[model samples]
Target: NKARMSAAGIVGFALEAAPRTTRAQSMDVLSSQANIAGYKAVLVAAHHYQRFMPMLMTAAGTVKAARVLILGAGVAGLQAIATAKRLGAVIEASDVRPAVKEQIESLGGKFLDVPFVTDEEREIAQGVGGYARPMPPDWMRRQAELVHERAKAADIVITTALIPGRQAPVLLKEETVKAMKPGSVVVDLAAAQGGNCPLTVADEVVERHGVTLIGHTNLAGMVAADASALYARNVLDFLKLIIDKEGKLAIDMKDDIVAACLMTKSREPELTS
Candidate 1:
């Protein structure tokens, strides 16, 4: 298609475009979709779990609030924390990056601090371009140990950990799932790229060791109306960078976003008045 476009003197750009450093975040399609996915993941977990999300006081008895553990403190994970907090769940979140600790607390969720013991571990934990890189095996081992204990106590677990162009990191092991209380729910948002939980079956809701695993890959698609609206706005924002005030197609290589998105340019150039 790119070759055909070039032959036809039509310029083309990548839809999923980002420079090393982004200037305008509003034009980020991935973040927009992820925001919706995060909000919906909590709702999905709430729907599956048999018990109530919030504690209830009644003449019959007192029901305890659900305990939610969120893996990954990215855009999706942070939104999940906010949504769960609004639903009155006791939320605990873990992430490779220590920077997200404040963001987690600001949303009324507890940050499960996994201290970096080694200097190398601390440097890698900083991550790249606002995305988490794969942690060292030793760090992963420690995280898994902490997650195991936490999962046992959690009524609902949502795993959103993923690395770009790589398989999603496994935060929840099969043993941890087995240890969890019966009727607990695990929502794996990284199902498409393997899962944060090893037991997850992509796009399928399954039961393992009395725990419900939701491996839905497209949580944003579940709420299509809002997702589409947000995506459309991202596209609109991106278009403004390439189009001039007089509605002329102005390809500015100086603009980081425009340069980054330029997948193909016309070889047989066509002049526009």
Candidate 2:
């Protein structure tokens, strides 16, 4: 049976049976890893522009602090905000989830709110998992307008909004990118999943109307060795529950977490290029 099952199949089964970790524990681990990526993304942006992140009190003149705007309040966004704050950049963040406001504020980052009157309060009170439920079309339009206004004022914008198993919501439009200040940078963390910026091309950094749009795919993979080790540990810990005393595989199909994470259907029958 072991020989019959492919390595990929075994790994997939192991992940499904992995021991459950509390949200707090998972967030802690994810944050630690994301912080490193956030710091590096900023450094990469700065190097690309040949600009200093910190203000210089040189004999010539004083340099202004860079302004960094992070969209989304998940692990990646929060880390980006913290990293930007540490580098002396003014950090701002936005999220559909109202609960994240406190999380952003706790890190000394300002939360940008879109004034859309809705039952978000009631929804938040209910405590839904992951992100707030998707907003109505009108609300999304209003939010986009507000975000676009804010994006124009930011020197660097990092977009990290992602909906599990779904394409990332479009946050920054092409016109918004064009409206940004010359030499401004926009990093889209959702590039791998179709991106949050209309102009973003996955894994490529291209200048659009003078603004730099960086659509980085698999940003975590940039730090491969560490990322791999952390991922391996997560996999190994989960695998312990699926493997018995003799290291034989056992699968429980009824587990909620397992059922939720499993890929159900294939979009196409076969690979085509």
Could you tell me every candidate's TM-score relative to the true structure? 0.93, 0.81
Write the residue-wise lDDT of candidate 1 on 15-66 in tens digits.
5666435566888888888989999999999999999999999999999999
Could you give candidate 2's per-residue lDDT for residues 1-273 as a string of tens digits?
434444334323323322334632332344445655675677667666546666778898998888788888877888788887788888889888777889999998999887557675445423345544566777688878888899999888898887755798899998888789899998888888899998899989898988888887766778778877876766565555445688865444454444444343223232111
- What is the lDDT, from 0 to 100, of the residue 237 in candidate 1? 86
Whole-model lDDT values for every prediction: 0.90, 0.71
lDDT of 1 at 68: 97
lDDT of 1: 0.90
Worst 10 residues of 2 by lDDT: 264-273
